[model samples]
Target: MAKVRLSAAAWGLSAVAAGTLVVGCSVSVNTGHAKPKILKDKLGDTVATRLAATTGQPKPDVTCPEDLVGEAGTTTRCTLTTGDGSTLGVTVTVTSVDGDNVNFHIKADETATPAAN
Candidate 1:
């Protein structure tokens, strides 16, 4: 049988690595915050639908964060990517929440997209 020896520096590094492997690990569960019923994705979809209906044009692409912790009455601005690969601003407001029904408002702002050469 052969005996193995480790230097002091090697022993210290091994200990640190072992400690990191053991104590530096953690588990994070993202249940999300207890937010209002109105979320950004649904709100964006609503905006797209309403805009299409009001303008009689095709529904533009609407994108929002996957998670939005909204208050009962709060307004936030989200970006809207149109069919032309240009971005616009859409303001969203969560007006109220009644029972299981949630109410919100969306206003599309007309900001011209710069010409791409």
Candidate 2:
């Protein structure tokens, strides 16, 4: 019957649409496996100073989590607390560093001050 034929065609079209969606949504895995450098706050004074300058805030007294080290050239999560009792949590990618000055890209949650309104 025509109704049976139409139903089969609709099922076939649905299957094709599902296949197309799955193929279109497929993503290739990244091949790069470079490991990122793990820097701890207790390692040395350089890391402490660098973290302080990078965040423009004082270093935190708490221990830094090991999982903060992300893949190289990728965003790494970091937390810094200033002496004034303010806390900053950020995701940053380090570009370069020289002495106490560090250059980096911040991903989000960069807070400075409340805007005057």
Candidate 3:
């Protein structure tokens, strides 16, 4: 996992609460024959839940174009669309994989893309 430095305010978290935010989730993966993948919807839901919990806002809508491979260094871009149709870019990266669990990190863009007229 690469070192990431962001102030708590960046994530809408207080210094104390930020410490409690574990940015990863454990999703079941089949380890047998093929590379495991985190389903797109599941990944989006996980991201939405985490963001909502940290920001004290309703869960935002998230959409990913494809599944994320369950391998360290794997990354996928997802979009968080606001009520006004402005979009925030979210980058999700796989940090590590342990048998059935795929741990990942999430980072939201610093600014939102304004809604189109």
lDDT values of the candidates?
Answer: 0.49, 0.36, 0.67
lDDT (Cα, tens digit) per residue for candidate 2, span 1-117 = 221112223323332333333222211222223543434443223333443344343432323454323333544555433334443343445454333333344332335222234
lDDT of 3 by residue, 8-105 (tens): 23333321232245344333444343566778898899877776677565666779888888889999999877666677777788888877577787
| Candidate order (lDDT) | 3, 1, 2
Could you tell me the TM-score of candidate 3?
0.72
Name the TM-score of candidate 2. 0.33
Candidate 1: tens digits of C-alpha lDDT, residues 1-23: 64233333433343333333322
TM-score of each: 0.57, 0.33, 0.72
Pull out the clashing pairs in model 3: none
